[model samples]
Target: MLSVMVVAATLFSVTTVMDSVETSIEKGTARLGADIMVVPAEAEAQAKTALLAGEPSTFYMDRSIEDKVRKVKGVKAVASQVFLKTAQYKCCSVGNMLLIGFDPKHDFTIMPWLSKELTRPLGTDEIIMGRGLTAYNVGSKIKFYGKYFEVVGMLEETGMKFIDNSVFMPYAAMKKLAEESKHKKGVKAANLPIDKISTVLVQVEPEISPQRVAIFIEHDIPGVKAIVSEQVISSVRKQLFVLLRSILSISIILWIMALLLIGVVFSMIVNERQREIGLLRAMGAKKSNIFRLIMTEASILSIMGGIVGIVLGGAFLYAFKGFIRSSLNIPYLWPSAAEYAVLVAGCLLLSFLTGAVAALWPAIRSMRMEPYEAIRRGE
Candidate 1:
């Protein structure tokens, strides 16, 4: 009985740990920026896919469109951003580095996240890189497709799927690289002139509805797609929660099945020990005392198993934290107090239930044992 309790408790702890790890990774991405996104009509499919899948993606947007967007009601602030495609730099290996071209002086929403790392707002010739570009640490000179530039700053680790693998620089820096590479190698940047940004980040007044603003933009503006941060995050969150719930459900079902097996095993043990139980009864032990002994053993086993499982689950969560975040396209935050409370409580409750359930049949059988027959078996 004790062994059965231990096994059931261990499985419960495993389920809790998995749940916490999944939640953490999803929340990390939400912390990096606003909830909304704007993409070019032509590139919306690719952008949405990348954002959800944690893969590299690029899109084009006309830089001139910002002026028109700013005029819309409820626009608190707007920042234009472009992501350059991956191409060979003069001296570096090929990897897609996000070239963010925004109004450095005016674009403070995303800039604050990069400020402490950068010497100053990026200049035409200077650039700040994502943690993914750590190879070009501060003071390292880098040449992108033949245009020479020095890495002035490296972004803090956000644990985000996309941000972790990106690099940012002034739009002009990218334009210069495109032009120079074209002149020298007779090739054009995937997208030229770079006047259009891939997306626009918008901040709206609290009193204004982002949904309303998005609707207005789509209706009033042409050649663009507008979506509020709330809309994007809500959509993403919904999908993630669905997955989390499914996992929880499966874990719960697994635990219940394990508990049933435990009960069956304990009942069988009781049958094999029928004579031993009858001997105790013959020795003047009360039926209640016999039941208590069995219950005590089951309880002890459950508590011990639960503790071991909790420790092992914690280790597993720590080891695979990064993989979970990257593969799921989410950020990872350590388990919080509330989450830990739930995990511990669930484990304890499940463990106790398994032990009690397992003892039920054995307890009843012991109560019914006859001392006369038990004594004969002992002989």
Candidate 2:
């Protein structure tokens, strides 16, 4: 039973982890809804980290670059964003967070998720939070640098940590915050690069290929790199797949060993029960009845162990999910309730089969024993 529990838990954990990584990447990219991201030449890695892990990547270029990218062929629209980290400023009391300054008029990706009441233009002192910031409500005020901004709205969950962990406001609002930060008495100056932007999100013309447009952007614009959205997801997929495959291989080996141990353990139990089995046969119990009795006992034990294992495994995963994500610096989202139910059902079925199959030979031997001969072996 103990062996089965360990094996079951291990198998469940690996399968859940793999599924979560794949789902998160798919959902996260879909939420982005943009064809390409253009960033400073050396900040490509930083941009990926910001998207995947929600870690602030403090790099910027002049806001004028937005105009240049728009003029490039095949580019239909351009939106500029500025990134800042709470750790850089005097607002350390609010904890570390990502600040995103977006052009709401040009931002199709984020604007669509804004609450209905917030459809109007946002004020310079107002900000919209991501769904992941559940602790704060719409009326809550967050102090940035030395100024406080009211939370005017909260966006829906995107399954992407980058957007979830970020706070969004207009470009002018962020600029105003920066300008005001310098005047606060005795406060450490929190300067967001004035008149600068971080990354440019681009949407390509319908007839033009995203990859082709990305290439053209890089060629036309100096000191900037264009990243097709899929490439970022693909890179993470390759890295996670390799890691998950290795974990799954180890789990398969452990499960096989547990199966063999169950067989050996059940054989010893049948030997010890020969006296009782002989008496039952002497009383006219059918061989088939004895076989079923043994199998029924094994099945019960296996299922109980499986259930316990699942409970422990699930608790561990849920409790440490945040820590695991932070350490890995990867985007991770749990499967929906229905999908998770299926996984749990599959594990339970595997557990039952493992015990039933291992007990087969022992049950056959017990049923084959003659009443008189079996009684002698028992003595």
Clash count in backbone of candidate 1 = 9
Q: Tens digits of per-residue lDDT for model 2 on 1-379?
A: 8877887787788788877888878777766768899999899988888888887668999888999999999999999998877754555446578889999879866777765456579999999888888888889988888778899888767667888888998988888877777897866666588778999999899999989999898899899989888888888889987888888788778778878988888889888889888999999999999999889888888888888888887988898888877766787878888878887887888889888988899999999999888888888
Shift in Å, residue 111, candidate 2: 3.1
TM-score of each: 0.72, 0.82
**Model 2 Cα displacement at 214 (Å)?**
3.0
Worst 10 residues of 1 by lDDT: 1-10
In model 2, the runs with Cα more than 4 Å from the true position are 62-77, 86-96, 114-117, 131-135, 156-161, 180-195, 203-213, 274-291, 318-322, 334-336, 363-379
| TM-score for candidate 1 | 0.72
Candidate 2 overall lDDT versus native: 0.84
